[model samples]
Target: MSSAPALADDCRFDDRAGLLAMSPEAFDNGPDEGWDALAERAGCQLEIAELFTAYRQQAKAAGHAGLAWHEATMRADAGQRDPAIALMRLTYKPHGADPEGWNHYVDATIAFLDDDLPALKRARARLAKLPMPLGNAREQGDDERPAGRPQLKIVDALIRCMYQPYALASESCPEP
Candidate 1:
């Protein structure tokens, strides 16, 4: 059996200190800065991946499944889909509650594939166990629960930005 990865020495900041030092602006900041810093400080992508893996493991062991899911999603969005999907599948059973969320997850995943219709269709069919959200509610509004989470909306926007295709400019380059 394969062992889980280890956290990088440099990326192993004390949670208490990090939280105490975190600014309001930092919360709104993109992960690129921090993730890049981690990669540079650790001196390798393997170490950075290990650090995130350890963090996810700790979150899962602590029963903070939502946090684990969030981390997994972030990693996936950053191009680590296999591990991310594995972690997500572990956190919540496929076809369990929150079908809408699962469908979105599958759709986002298929969007990342290299336009393989057979694979895409298979994934869509497998994810059919989950219901799609009505009228893109996942993107348009915040989830109105006691939790009041905005992460879902953020994920939707990220997926759209990441996977949606764009047209190329014409060679003539004439202004429309």
Candidate 2:
């Protein structure tokens, strides 16, 4: 909290107009944490966390997996590591239909937040080596992704995030 964190392009949370203008679909679909990071900079995570928690519950009740992870991430940003990890383990059950690399990504994320760099590195290596999902196993942005390892950017970003707090680094992560 020394100074407000900025996005890669140096956007600061002096105001929340753009963030507030975003639709729910935009928040859920955005790969970047710009909105949440700005919210944190604006001291808005308390309200945001409540919304994510409710969304997590609905997602869990409906058997969806992603929103639980979302809540866990917010908790991690808030430095509630134990609860974050526990909620991740409890709510976001991996499905048979998920990509192999996705499982490793989850491990990487949890380990990163847990301050276990060795485990995070191992998971990143595994993710880097994973073959492209054969047919329909591609995640949303995979279609636009160049033909190569997928999701490595996110792992690298998590590593860079180690230089500072996840709350601050998440916004500044250029790879995201």
Candidate 3:
């Protein structure tokens, strides 16, 4: 797969004011053209991939869950499900008494992949009951708090809910 783009040598969104002024709309305006320009200006897949991965990891650590997820999701290989599934599993693992949000994530992922109305409906129902703090924060444009009680609880719950479904699905469909 092609790696993410690198920033231009003269790109000047280095400060807070510059960042704030940089609208998300700009990114959305012409992604392919922008990426092509960036690729042309900064030539090196390794450098671009490293920069993209670093940004994604930093976003995750900084509670910018939406950005982190978006980065991962966008780069997911079309024929590869393992990485996506692994990510879902990691996000929902439980820590203590609480259930993580793994279940909701898994359900959502399955719904996204399957395109089955029944599965989608079931996933949506389960999702409605889950706290889904990270999902909620992303929707509200609020940064997720560092991993803690609420995060753990949601993660655990998600894990529990998704476990059986994931297992069953995997069993039914072996990877080639």
Candidate 4:
């Protein structure tokens, strides 16, 4: 409260020397110690969206495929739908894992961004029909999706909540 930073104030980072000096070891963690709590300490800070996009790009080029995905979602959240859709389309894409489920998920996400509920519904239906993967290939456990692709669930919830912004509807819609 009294000292909370406004979310809309800016995406700020600074102390390049300090951050680089700290590197991977200096990340903040929540009290759970299992979550990466975002850094709140301030000595010198700066805010600019360009740094984020560029950081994602550099990380992706260095083979962080998932960070690139995060960038796409970031763009979409910023209401930059076209760029997000384009970036999503160009990804190495889901043609690898459960291609059917993943591809449909991508289509549905684009549809959601486009506000094409019909297309979203169609894609969600396709995903629902596919054999579910055991768990997200990356991580498992409590986040394990017992029924189907987490993406499918997200689309379904988006539809259930009438596709409101994920943040707006996530309480009713749950996952993002």
Candidate 5:
């Protein structure tokens, strides 16, 4: 399993513009160790769904719902289902920290995953009302942070991989 790339010597998180200025490739190629192995183990959609369901359940049982659910979404992204569905699930998490417009986003994701394109389209219409920065923002800290949301970029890369898996081999964003 390969690790996430180390920041280039020239890069610095402290500088908002510089951080945002860095090319998407810089962050897209982060570590995704063992994802291929995990995916291979779960060959079909049913296997992947079962695996993710168990993982989500366990995460909730152990009281790590927020992070665990996020991780499960990532796993779903790596599984046999449509990559777009996986990407949507991760990006459209509902009932978490900020549930404001997440319900529609989640509805769209489920509809997409279930192969109900019409439902997904309708749900997406509702999701259009949300604010610009898609997905839940990582909790901000007292210290300064980057201007761009790298995590959202991560989601973008995942969506790309769904349609072009081999081209972005190490670009998958597995849970840390």
Candidate 6:
């Protein structure tokens, strides 16, 4: 069996302490490669994956999609097949007919996990085609991206992390 990839000393996704010390913007602006490296590093921590799964079960029981998604991501980082498939399905399962921008986001996430560069690009283009938030209003320090667009930022961060490794490092934050 293949072993997990080695991580640099500064990679913050290795444990709760590092994760806590990190800022949210890191995931937003950090190098795409860093996200990838984190995921690769996660593969070596099966114990952490199990904990994530337990947390996912709790989140699901509480009907918290956001928390479930986060835990699912941790599981996915450990190369858990169920979480990867479930993550895509959960994102795609909601919203029938006109899926708004979710289709792009879901597609982008799947492509990222699959390492399909072309598909990821196409999905990102589709997402970009959607109207961006109006005006350059002052940024809020809140956890969410904005109203009516829950989890978009998280999805983008996950996508960036899944595809590349060891890019210019930036800040990140705990999932709110």
* Candidate maximizing TM-score: 2
RMSD of each: 10.6, 7.1, 12.9, 6.7, 13.9, 10.2
lDDT of 4 at 33: 26
RMSD of 3: 12.9
Per-candidate TM equals: 0.37, 0.62, 0.33, 0.62, 0.34, 0.47
Per-residue lDDT of model 4, residues 48-114, tens digit only = 2233355544332454454345456555655567877876775545456555466787788888778
lDDT of 6 at 107: 76
lDDT of 5 by residue, 54-92 (tens): 444432334333333334444444443455354345544
| Runs off by more than 4 Å, candidate 6 | 1-45, 96-103, 134-176
Q: For model 1, how does the per-residue alpha-carbon lDDT over 68-122 read when each residue is reduced to its tens digit?
A: 4544545553456566666666565455566455554445344443334445445
Model 5, 106: alpha-carbon shift in Å? 1.8
Q: Model 3: per-residue lDDT, tens digit, 1-176?
A: 23234455443223423322333433223464222233333223333333334544432344333433333333332223455445444444344433444455555664544434466456556555655555555566666544323433333333344433332232232322
* Runs in model 1 lying further than 4 Å from the true structure: 1-52, 59-62, 94-96, 107-176
Per-candidate Cα lDDT values, in order, are: 0.42, 0.61, 0.40, 0.52, 0.41, 0.48
Off by over 4 Å in 2: 1-41, 58-61, 91-96, 134-150, 174-176
> Which pairs clash (backbone N, Cα, C closer than 3 Å) in model 5?
3-31, 4-31
TM-score-better candidate, 2 vs 6? 2
Candidate 6 or 1, higher TM-score? 6
Q: State the displacement of the C-alpha of residue 24, model 1, in Å, after optimal TM-score superposition.
A: 19
Cα misplacement distance, residue 10 of candidate 5 (Å): 31
Go through the candidates in order and give the clash count of each: 0, 0, 14, 1, 2, 10
Off by over 4 Å in 3: 1-68, 77-81, 93-102, 114-117, 130-176
Report lDDT (Cα) of residue 83, candidate 5.
Answer: 51
Q: Write the per-residue lDDT of candidate 6 for residues 1-176, one digit (tens) a residue.
A: 12354454533345554432334334223565223334444334444444334444532334434434444455455565466657556645455543467667767666666667788777777776675454313244444434434435645555555544312101142243
Model 1, position 67: C-alpha lDDT score: 42
CA error at residue 23 for candidate 5, angstroms: 32
TM-score of 1: 0.37
Model 1 per-residue lDDT at 24: 25
**What are the runs in model 5 whose C-alpha is more than 4 Å off?**
1-63, 78-99, 131-176
